[model samples]
Target: MAENIVQRLRDEIENGIVTNQFAPGDRLDEMQLAKHFGVSRTPIREALMQLGAIGLIEMRPRRGAVVVEPGPHRIYEMFEVMAELEGMAGSLAARRHTDTDRTGLLAAHARCEHSANADDADTYYYDNELFHHAIYTASHSSFLIEQCTALHRRLRPYRRLQLRVRNRMKTSFSEHGGIVEAILSGEAELARTLLRQHIAVQGDRFSDLVATLSQREAHSG
Candidate 1:
């Protein structure tokens, strides 16, 4: 029951941050949050700590927890690191995946396909996370999986936002198809390259993400 409450509070707080209801630099008061959510301070603090671990918020000296506003350059750098880590994971998966891994990856991919076809960005985003997790698991490296999962969590909101861009979900699905093929075929180098390109924010994608962030900030302001 306590665990469930923490998770619910975490999700609600995360959603608030993602939707800009809790804008960057806004102080998150534990007592106020507890009152608003009708929960105790303990769960609210735990949820904020989780968000801080995922880079969504920061604990200040006297201001309590405040939302983090990562700039575009920092976000891009983080994506670059994520792309490389994911690429390495893909390469390892191509070389080391077992039959169980194959089945899991395919199932995750199928779910993503269904969501994409339904044209539901939110659903697709959730499925997309499963698909990436499948790949990380397939890599068979505990360390790589840990690192990838950590960074992936940190980038969750931005990745979901990227899917909201016009035609991005379809494009992302198509890219996943290629990644699946390469990994299944045991093409290590190809899988690495494909995953890198699929993850890295560049050119038009960078512009689209920045524009979306700007729009959200404007509305929230």
Candidate 2:
């Protein structure tokens, strides 16, 4: 029962089923969710506790537990951090990855190409992530992979949203090709610079994308 309830909660949170219905900083009604899950408050409590530990939601005194949003500035801050981490991964991957690692990355790149050509942005999003993850793992550094993946997960929602930017998927796919070429040539410095810019550059489109998303939500609401 406990495990089932925890997994259910995890799925709901990860799929944005709850967040879509509730705003950031809003308290979660434990009784409501417990009822929805057809379970006692015990597992619900356990789930909330676990989420709090992960920095997803915060448990408060009287107001109850609320989801935390990183707000505006936090988005740029995360990108800055991601740029450095990804640059390091690219640098190491260029020099250290096995031939098989290069093969896996090329496969992921092919998937991205197919998805982009199809205008299947959702599929591209998934493949793009896999491609980046392949590079990170290619570094053969467990500690680096773990840290990079954690940060990537935290930034997942933002990255997911950016996939909707006009023609961004195709542009991203092209950039991925460049990175792959650099890595294939063992150009560590070139790979690092390209990877960092690839992750960090919104290129005059950041505000437009932000505006579009904001307007979209307002309209949908």
Candidate 3:
């Protein structure tokens, strides 16, 4: 029961931060949050600690927990590293994936397609995580999978926010189709290239992300 409360608080807090309800640098008061959620302080503290672990918040001495404001440059750098890691994973999966891996990947891809066709960005975002996880598992390198998973979690909110851009879900689903074909056909280089392009934040996509953040900040302000 306590654990459930903590999980709920964590999700609620995370959603609040991602949606800009709790803007960057905003203090997260334990007592106030406990009152707002109608839970004990213990769960609020636990949730803040979890958020801190994932780079969403900072626990500072004397100041308590505050939301972390990720700069555009920092976000771009993170995506650059993420793209390389995912590309490597794609390459390995193209070469090493087993029958079971193939089946899982296809199933995940189909789920993503369904969500995309329905124009449900929220559902597609969840399905997108599974789709990427399927590729990471197919890579068959435990170390690479661990690294990819960690970075993916750290970037979760930003990635989810990106899906709200016009037609992004459909475009992402289309890219997944190409990636699926490349991996299944054992085209390692092609898979690597395609995955890198799909994950990298650049060009118009980068502009779109910055614009969206600006709009959110304007509204929140």
Per-prediction backbone clash count: 0, 0, 0
- What's the residue-level lDDT of 212 in candidate 3? 80
The best candidate in terms of TM-score: 3
lDDT per residue as tens, model 2, 124-159: 878989999999988888999998998887766567
lDDT of 3: 0.88
Instruction: Give per-model CA RMSD.
Output: 2.7, 4.1, 2.5
Candidate 1, 6-71: lDDT as tens digits: 977987888788666898889999999999999899999999999999889999999989999676
* Global lDDT scores for all candidate models: 0.89, 0.79, 0.88
TM-score of model 2 (CA atoms): 0.77
Tens digit per residue, CA lDDT, model 3, 1-221: 88878877887898788666898989999999999998889989999998898899998888899999577678778889999999999999999999999999999999999999999987898899999999999999999999999998887767877887787788999999999999999999999999999988432475577778779778877
- Indicate whether candidate 1 or candidate 2 has the larger lDDT: 1
TM-score, every prediction: 0.85, 0.77, 0.87
> Which residues of candidate 2, in runs, are more than 4 Å off?
1-21, 30-54, 61-65, 202-207, 216-221
